[model samples]
Target: MGTWEAVRRGRLLIALLVAAAAIPPASSAAATTLPKKAKASSPPELLSELPVHAGRLVPSSVVFPIYGDVYPHGLYYVVMNIGDPSKPYFLDVDTGSDLTWLQCDAPCVSCSKGPHPWYRPKKSKLVPSGDPLCAALHSGIAQGENSGQCDYEIQYEDRGSSLGVLLYDAFSLRLTNSTRASPILAVGCGYDQQSAVQDASAPTDGVLGLGTGKVSVLSQLSNQGVTKNVVGHCLSGKGGGYLFFGDDLVPSSRMTWAPMSRIGFRNYYSPGPAKLYWGTQSLGAKQIEVVLDTGSTFTYFESHPYQAFLSAVKSDLSKTPLIEEFDDSALPVCWKGQKPFKSVSDVKKYFKTLALDFVKGKRALLELSPENYLIITKHGNACLGILNGSEAGLRNLNVIGDISLQDHMVVYDNEKQHIGWVRAACNRLPNADDHGLEDGDLSQYASMGVLK
Candidate 1:
């Protein structure tokens, strides 16, 4: 799928998780997996404390993979590595995404499987586990000695990935303070293979999903403290942001509140880049505590008010020669001069225009001229369905995936209560950074909202 199309179709199209290597209990929903509760309080004392995380943090920058683009233009930088911490790896500390991976050693056939871009170990300074410097990492998050190489395969809600061996690397995690510091245990590794159409690429190592589960890097960091919990407030826009690994990072103020529902780890994760919902009407009838996920590209909700949403905007479309769903995209163009020729790209544009009304005053309808918004599937053909999650049977639960979180600053405070969001206007630069994208793919377009 094209980049914007992926965004519009469902920002939550890709996600992965490494479970207990065992089947979840039968009670867990087929799509969701709640996390197992660990020690509620932080550790009593730092287990093998590393002074590197202490002292003055440094400025660090990590790359975010711009889905569907093929050049560096699609990639943007997030200040993640705080100073010169002992371990550093580029990570999109996202609740929307699941797997925590990094770029690793290349030259393996297993790494070339997917169409999306994969990380290349060759460009990174962090060596694979086989190297002597990375022995400690293997003992921690990289656990395993049989093979000193980093290897992992994670399956997200929508996508599955195979990552190469883990390598101890440096990553930047930015703080709202305009300061950067590298995490002490940053690891680097990339997906070995990706599906061709997925638009995967090797941006900067991999993503770090900070969901409410044991597998999260935040949870892993908890191995260091007691009484203090990990807290992260990822600001939505360009003023930049900070992610707190421990309690010391939290601010002193009255915080918004929401009772957290500890559910299955994978089942409850939401998609991100963060979408804010204001007003009581936007909150809907459900008072569910949710996580914002970046791994997914689309939104998922229980039949919520989808029908109401569609009913409100269905009349805005015009009839065209496009066909919505076709097992084969190569269709016979019977109408040679039809004004609205149906195509996949047209379908994507249609969804993009439709999503504007869902958010509060947030209009992503960029240069979508009349000609630019094409049609797919005939006006009444049932084959071309607008929403994709319904077909995949992901509608049972409430999830605000990528599509819904667009253009807003989301604050996911697991330490506190409730997920908070605020309106943000970002300048969508044309030079979309595509650092991690695959070759010859113009479908991906990464936009770093230069917060206005």
Candidate 2:
């Protein structure tokens, strides 16, 4: 499934501790053989002393698998090297899903086994017996050596799951030429996983969440001082983008700043808001709130605003014939006839720019034209990436998912308690002497009222 569709369809595997209400009891939800936990917190949250930093960028290689064009663009995969021999593992890069887990050699009831050999922690020096840190990760009742290891279970809304032991291990960011090392970070050694889609040969090892969740790989790195608690990703609409850690990834001077805020946790781990104004004709003249989520695959809104957005968008396309019955897209809304246009390039001119407007009238405009959110499928049909959030089970908030984030440098700055973005052609942005937008201008966004 496409990343956006995955979020809507609920094809997710969020950690049990991160979203306990969404999952089952840790013991009953996972393998029956190993020790179980009545409840569990992510390893990073359990950590009292954060690890030290080496100061480097961890580059994980990503591959965009082709889901149907009807679906939003596909999800990316991360390849990491683990263990003493540094075996390679293919996993998904999910920003909202935390816990870096891998399919283990232990055992499984109904999981599709990957081609790579399962990682056996016995040989690795990363986790030793009687370590308090590992004990802190313990779940259910602690058994003995082979069993007392920290247990973790992640159950998805769709009923798929990965339950297993947790491990702190050496990980390498797989890069060309040379590999960068990392201090031991928390990783879920998932031995058993239930796959919604079969063909064991095809399943990704596990997910690597690069989100704000405390246990997330991004947070783990930051807590350890490898980099500041900052993360950024630039996904290209055409394909191929980069994910980075640390200030050196992009110079602060080159970025345009905007205040990014989150409502006090829960109501779904967290709901983020971005104030903006969108319109073409008489519609979209008022300010709107969209939830910033990498977990969601597309943009969405309530029925009222959806109609406004649709009408506003339709008013501008005088030349393009929009086919309403686009069966190719998994999204609720899609159109065709804009193609003879492979990709969205040909139809981009007719689309509009979406602006991020603040209280002081300071605006950060993002071009959400076809080049950004429209997917021209292999079937030659053009699919609009934005959908109705209400139909997708989002009630109180509109979503600004990955599709809308394409081609932009989005920065998640937890240290300064701010977030910002700027449009850039390259995934690897150039360093700037003066980083960030003017502080006073950013205050406009910082001061806007939050939705939640």
Candidate 3:
């Protein structure tokens, strides 16, 4: 599966912002100072065994504070401390991809400018080529029996790529139960990185893949008994949110859930077929499968659904003073008012709320208000955040991106094979008492057999 599809879209957004003059010019000092390089280390010997394990007393849940925003950054990121000394690196959080990777200082052939220094792996941390995790990275390719460094290469649909070797490193984490744990996990040490659009301002050091594949960080943590094989995130529209591993933050009630679709690729979180609706009216589009991807900056719909959605919105705006703004290059579709729109609330009166009524799991309904699908550009015009997936080479795939996920607690319950969501005030983290779980109590979790 392509891991950087959403990242490529984010780059597209960056290019658009540059074109619209939304991004300010950098100072001479900031532009001239390049990221420092690190020396390359020799490949290490094969690991005899996986060294990480979580005891029965380990916490069931861990939460990380998320930084960055969808508007200026086009992504949300989390800082993770890795390696023996625990160096922090900013990772763009992506739920669509599987393998977690960091740009390495192994004398990188080509690398993007990031906020932190390159990750230098130790000589003893290299993963062997004969490992099963290495085989997963080489899926569909024939592998030899020779034992050496586990080399990997990933190419994105947007022509971005990474060449790297796999390694195991310590991830220092503090659980919500006030316990600290260090888990050794597999990670890609990318020695070379290339992108279709080179944005020096993009601050991500690498990707934090949260997909359902066995190679995902979440799955590895689950296997090591660090936390349950579940993950959730709440991305605020205003900025900054929280990401948690396990079910401690999940509400006991008042959350709508839909079964995860098993029909498609395994890495994505697909919530089966859903019919499109404009308020209460059906848009006459066929039921479209939706994948919740945190990596993408904007929502994408299949061709038919996208066209129907565009027409419905245009028809509703016919009676209003809002006119199509073709000059705005920020987004494909945008509308300008009598005066420039200061926010989505300024022009929301002209548009109706859109909903996706799922055909499965109690017919769960996902409502998207104007603010959810409209972005107020730097030009002060409201632009449509929903794009045509086919045009972006997604073909029939429909994606629910960050724009539509604002202010919602989205949960991916891999252990239960379902996805859940509820409207939330994402500005703050939920208290332990709010979820009915007292501090330092794993008894309830043990009763459910989730805790060891």
Q: Return the top candidate by TM-score.
A: 3
Instruction: Assess each prediction's global lDDT (C-alpha) against the native.
Output: 0.35, 0.51, 0.71
Tens-place lDDT digits, model 1, residues 107-208? 444442222333444223333333322333222344333332334455544444544433433333332222333333434354344532355443333566
Runs of candidate 1 exceeding 4 Å displacement: 1-16, 19-93, 112-151, 165-167, 172-180, 186-188, 196-205, 219-257, 267-291, 303-305, 315-388, 393-395, 425-452
Quote each prediction's TM-score: 0.50, 0.71, 0.84
- The sequence of per-residue lDDT tens digits that candidate 3 reaches over residues 320-400 is 999899877667788888887788889888889899888888959898988799988778888888999889877787889
Candidate RMSDs in order = 12.3, 9.3, 8.9
Q: List residue ranges in candidate 2 displaced over 4 A.
A: 1-33, 36-73, 113-115, 121-149, 155-160, 173-180, 195-203, 266-272, 279-289, 318-320, 358-362, 427-452
lDDT of 2 by residue, 1-452 (tens): 22333433324333334322122224443444333322333332222122333743443211112111124435545456665456767666555555677776554444565647666654232232234434333322233443334555666433467766666665644221122444557777776676655443533566766656665666766765555676666665655455556554455465665555554442122223334434434334555555455554566676677777777676666456765654653545556774455757666666776554543213544446556567665566666676766664555556666677777767767666556677765333334223332322212222111110
The alpha-carbon lDDT assigned to residue 175 of candidate 3 equals: 66
